[model samples]
Target: MSKIDSAERARALDLVPVSRETAERLDVIVALLEKWQRTINLVAPATLPQLWTRHVADSLQLVPLAGQVTRWVDLGSGGGFPGLVVAAALAEIPAADVTLVESDSRKAAFLREAARVAELPVTVVPARIEQVAAQLAPGVEVVSARALAPLSRLIELAHPFLAKGAVGLFLKGQDVDNELTESAKSWRISSRIAPSLTDRSGRILIVTSAVPLAPIKEAAGNAKGSTHD
Candidate 1:
């Protein structure tokens, strides 16, 4: 097994302290991710060295934002960022669970195995975000996506859950201002931007509501015409 940076793990725990059991589960997830990377491009290869601070800590920061919400749906849960991470923390909470949606079959397989190994309450769905949006949106309390899409399209993809009162917590980069501006053209977003605990350039968008300004068909057409993220 490749040795993880102890200092980095400590730094991440300081940022978002978790129970020992949860921390252990997260460790297992990290190991699983590292193993899977050999065969699948789970995350950016360059980011592996700083995985604890960059990905794990970044994902851990989202846990407190949901504030006891147990039912979560992680859209585009590539490599199980906040999804599995959230599930790790919520393991102690009664009835807490996270549904991870990943379209790539290989990645989905990794998620299932990781969740199993970590003993987290997670359901891995091997399907596209659009295909299962409505089915999964019904009772989800929180919706999350990291590095998935632009704010405009993300809102579109997460609309069903948001409209039904699920709070959306999306991790974004420095271009957030531009993305927010672009999103405003299509959606009336009720949100607040929170500074990231890990990266200075990162921002966490907490969206309480998002009502589309365009007609449904128009929005669908626009989504189809735009480049996929």
Candidate 2:
């Protein structure tokens, strides 16, 4: 637990630093992602240079917001973004745990390896968001998602977890205004949008509720990949 400077310490938010011990593990994750992506195409290659900020820092930024979150579920954890970063930072917080859910097998494998090398208490579930109906742990306090879908779809994908009493934290882009407008038509959830630490145009949505569409309508929407994915 080396003492980081004020700014860097602020970044950890009373948690742990992603320093030497953690860096080695994170490096392993990065290396593996870069390697597998050549064939599987996980993350956008052009974004590699900002991986530390766009992905890692973006996820880690949440640590300070919820200073003592013990458990979290990350939906659509493609390429491990905030999910792996959250797990790695939480690895330093006693009793902290995270679950990373990804539909892609290659991404799931990367998440598993990241957890192993980082020695973080994280579970990776390789399944589509809709397939895994919301049985999150009863006491899970936080639920996060990154680059998954529109705000409306995110609320639907998170319906299960939100119903189970988890607060939703989703990373969205500048077009949030348009998405929010469209999402309002189908679901009703109270949310606050905040600026993202990594991307100037990105927004972090903090939500508390999500009303579901009727089963008949939901089923119809699913057929078109519009309800949840």
Q: Tell me the TM-score of each prediction against the true structure.
A: 0.93, 0.81
Could you tell me how far off, in angstroms, the CA of residue 97 lies in candidate 1 after the best superposition? 1.8
Residue by residue across 63-177, what tens digits does model 2's lDDT show? 6666578898888777777777777767766888898877667668777876787677899888766766556546788888877766776777777788888888887889988
Give stretches of model 1 more than 4 Å off: 1-4, 218-229
Runs with alpha carbons beyond 4 Å of true place in candidate 2: 1-24, 213-229
The TM-score between candidate 2 and the true structure equals: 0.81
RMSD of candidate 1 to the truth, in angstroms, is 3.2
- Error of model 1, residue 158, in angstroms: 0.4
| Candidate whose TM-score is highest | 1
CA RMSD (A), model 2: 6.0
Error of 2 at 27 (Å): 3.3
RMSD of each: 3.2, 6.0
Query: For model 1, what is the error of residue 64's alpha carbon versus the real structure, in angstroms, after optimal superposition?
Result: 0.5
